[model samples]
Target: MSEEFTYATSEGPNGWTIWQVIGRIDVSTADEAYASGEEIVKGNEKIAIDLSTLEYISSAGLRVILRLNKLAKKSGHKLTVCGAYGMVKSVLKDSGMDVLLAAKESLDELS
Candidate 1:
């Protein structure tokens, strides 16, 4: 068995894509994360992953973020990480994903 997690996608202010992630994100759940995010980004120009509620993230989770970043860039969209705190923020910065996700301290900055 594997750990469980949950996520949700919604529209943010200014027509941005918002993905709210919760629980642990590891190898087993990376696919789900990717799929959900992929769909949320459809026909959207700005994407933001709300990680304030997320507890943990492994390399696999990082990969999911990277993939989203690539897709957004290829489509000429912007991807930002909104409210990434504690370890989640550290992981993004440590892996240098902050450059790709452009992790923002506030949701307002994400727009």
Candidate 2:
């Protein structure tokens, strides 16, 4: 069975909305991730996707990140990602998404 994918949101310092993505984000879960991310983008000006609990991410998952970036930009909002480690971090780096996502070491960097 696939690992259940899930995400949560919280308020961060400096008016940033924190979205914490958890579990595997493969083809099966990418669509949901994108939809939910879009909703969050619509509601907030500053957004951060915290990958601290994320275990795996596929190319489809990367597409979601790119889509969110576009949506945030089009809506005149700020978006960043942080706390990626292990294989999740490697995948983002290898795909050169780390730069596009503006990956940060932690949430405090946003403040």
Candidate 3:
């Protein structure tokens, strides 16, 4: 069976957009997650990704996030990830993406 992933976007403080990702963000759903994030960043100067409900993520997902970070930099936008926990945070930390993406501790910390 194919796993389903859901990603939703909303307005954040100071008009920044927040993309709340739910479900597993693995190889099967990485593209959809990336596309959703891309659409939010297209017109906004700041974007936050909420990983509170995200259960799993793979290398493909990390690659997508890295690509988004680069795109955000070139477009003069800010990209931050919030609420990563357990294995999700471990993977990010292990891959050194936690540093590269500048993933923040929490939304409150960013505020």
Candidate 4:
């Protein structure tokens, strides 16, 4: 079965663009989500991702986030993720990416 994922972007305080991701992010939708993030990171200097609505994420999805985080750093932009909870946050913490990416408590922390 195919799952539906929604991705939207909005302006945050202090020039950061917040990308709100909803639904499950798995192999089926990881590429799309990653592309969306890449486009924003390419055009904006500050990017924040909100995962509050994200219900589930697979390793593929995590890879996409890691890639975007690396790209953001390489391009001299900042990438922050917030609102991760339960399994989503557990995966990140277990993989040690939580520290590597320097995830903030919220987008406001980035400011």
Q: Per-candidate TM vs. native?
A: 0.89, 0.95, 0.92, 0.92
Residue 103, model 3: Cα distance from true site in angstroms: 1.6
Question: How do the residues 1-111 of candidate 1 rate in per-residue lDDT, one tens digit apiece?
Answer: 226779877888887888888887889888988888888766678888898889899999999888888898888888888898898889888988887667788777754
Q: Lowest-lDDT window of 10 residues in candidate 3?
A: 1-10
- Top TM-score prediction, candidate number: 2
The global Cα lDDT (0 to 1) of model 1 is: 0.84
Candidate ranking under lDDT, highest first, comes to: 2, 4, 3, 1
- Residues 1-111 of candidate 2 have per-residue lDDT tens digits of 339689999999989999999997889999899989999999999999999999999999999999999999999999999999999899999999987877798888987
Tens digits of per-residue lDDT for model 3, 12-105: 7776688888888888988888888788777788889888878888998898788888889999999899989998899999999888886777
The superposed Cα distance between candidate 3 and the true structure at residue 89, in angstroms, equals: 0.4
Model 1: how far residue 25 lies from native, Å: 1.5
Supply every candidate's count of residue pairs whose N, Cα or C atoms clash at under 3 angstroms. 0, 0, 0, 0
| Number of backbone clashes in candidate 4 | 0
Give each prediction's root-mean-square deviation over alpha carbons: 2.2, 1.3, 1.8, 1.8
Evaluate model 1: give its TM-score: 0.89
Residue-level lDDT of model 4, residues 77-102, one tens digit each, is 98889988988899889988898876
How accurate locally is residue 80 in candidate 3, as Cα lDDT from 0 to 100? 92
Better structure of 3 and 4 per lDDT: 4
lDDT at position 82, candidate 2? 90
Task: Tally clashing residue pairs in candidate 3.
Answer: 0
After superposing candidate 2, which stretches have Cα over 4 Å from the reference?
A: none
Write down the lDDT of every candidate, Cα atoms only: 0.84, 0.91, 0.84, 0.87
